[model samples]
Target: MKNVIFLIIFLFCLNSYSQEFKNITIIKSDKTEIKTLGTFVYEDDLIKGIKTKKNNLLISFQDVNKVFINKETYLVKNYKFKKYLFLKIINGNLSLYKDKKNYYLENNELGLKNIKKDEKRLQFVFKTGEVSLFINKCKAATNELYNKRKSLILSNLKKIINIYNTCDTSSKIQFADEVIKESNRPKEKVKFGLSFGLMKLKTDYNQPFSIEGSDKNFTFVGGKVYIFSNIFQEKLDANLSIDYFFRKNYQINDIDYYIKNSTQFTKLTIGANYTINNISKLITPYFGISGGLLLSSNSSVKLISKYLDLPSRHYTLSNELIYNINVGSYIYLLNQKIDLIFEYQPKINTKLSDSINLHNNSSSFSSLSFKLSYIF
Candidate 1:
């Protein structure tokens, strides 16, 4: 009776252990499927199969059609001359898959030994009808390649989705093929734009020579033109710009003396801009910073020593450095090739030097600009 009880307990333990292993179904290339009880282990292009009461099996990825393990299905995919095991998340005409790829890096140590390390990265796979698209989720690569290709990937995905939604079963294959063809084509790397806008400038001078009363502030009208290039990515831009300001006049009065001045400021700037939002959309916002040379030309100040009784003294202001910070937006039209831009530059500061003494003086200003640009 005790022996019978032991045998029953042993059989029950065996049954429980078998239940712990998942059921895996492997579909072969010849339209045959095999059911195996094992724990599936995947390493690159091979799946290690540890079967019950059988020798371990090593299955080549190319010979396998699909794998069902742990109640989940994985499809074998080929991309960029590499094989990927994709976990199918959505099963329909258009499917989404989670993909994993293993990468090996070689390190040389002591000039004689080579060490190899493996890294696994996760990526996304989209299957539209019969077309497959791969999206990389790793940011380890340089921004140049990633930025240039990111928009292409998004555009292809959008096209694929649209085609899948509109096409019927008979025409789906043709549309999928078109999408694949378009996706495989090389995309544009560089985009160029030109901007022209109006600007307003207000100058504030500091301390020792602080103007009194209404003369403390001076406002001027200006116009600026800039040529900008999209570099590295769509969200970043490199710009070269020039600005011309109209003449502004001011009058200063002290108890014993009066002074009159007229000034015109011009600037040549080189800078960069970073867009905070979607660059491919109809409207995108950006912020920029620039540093340049400011030329204060036709600037003459006349000082009457005593109420027009003494001869007036004339002095000219010298050129100085101009630093600017601006916030702006781009409204895209004509398929994003043309844009209308509106920008508000709140802080533009420069230091004007005295031509005779080379003494530095501060000038602070602000401007609003409107420009039309073309992207190529």
Candidate 2:
């Protein structure tokens, strides 16, 4: 009875693990069907493939006539010995297709015949009666050939429009507009956001002078607004931000001498961030290094003069050039228009002045900040 119960539990776990993968159906050219239990995609080769628990399977582009995933069908179409996978039929005999190509380099170790590079291009297909037009990138083609391709595309598009007019003209205008918009949409290139949080000083000071009674932990409340531009489109970003910290006061006492001090720190940062641009995903993480100038000053100091009289004095700490490293993750919500970000940044100890230093007799300063940012 114990062995039977263990076997039943093992089977139950195996069934649950198998349910994690989606079912895929591949229809071959010979009218045979391959029913597989795994996720599949079109990778480097001109074929549709899947990685299964047992082994990887690659079906030739010519052999695969259709693929069915979750009741949705993808038709395999061939042009000039290259296969294109069309997702579904659009309005008035139009369809969306993905074109993939592999490029080989002459100096590559694998030789010129072996593919060393790959790219996927979005394509639109328009078909009417016996006419078909596939619109793709033609930047490298000659002007004459480019114009010819464009003319053919427009001509076929007109036929599709005429067919739509004869049928459902109610949705033609909206459908045509959607197709045009999708074809000409620009890629996302820039993002802007604002962040607010508290910054805490985490430096250990080897002070030449001592304060008899003082709080060692110094924290400042501040906010920053930043703009990020894609430097390498989806991989890296150039970041710029202006940070403003509110003024903070510290009271120091040294046995019969009392001092009142206040300070404000502002900085302008220029940095680069390596971002994983999975905007379509729920969470994205990034890390970066930045160098900036901290515009700082000591506002007013009240202390007892040598004559046993209290006096107020104003002094300035020189502007500081500092470097820092930051790590953060963005929680995307509401179609990525808004984000809740959590960040931890550690500032490297940089010298502020040759004379006076805040809290510490040493010239260097350091801070750790926790921030939350929203991006639109």
Q: Model 1, 186-255: lDDT tens per residue?
A: 4434445554445444444434345543423333333333344334335666666665666768777776
Worst 10 residues of 1 by lDDT: 106-115
Candidate 2: list runs displaced more than 4 Å: 1-188, 203-205, 211-233, 255-259, 276-280, 298-315, 336-362
- Give candidate 1 regions above 4 Å deviation: 1-19, 22-46, 53-200, 210-241, 253-259, 270-290, 302-314, 329-376
Candidate 2 has a TM-score of: 0.42
Q: How badly does each model clash, as a count of residue pairs? A: 0, 0
TM-score of each: 0.47, 0.42
Candidate 1 RMSD computed on C-alpha atoms after optimal superposition onto the true structure: 11.5
Q: How many clashing pairs does model 1 include?
A: 0
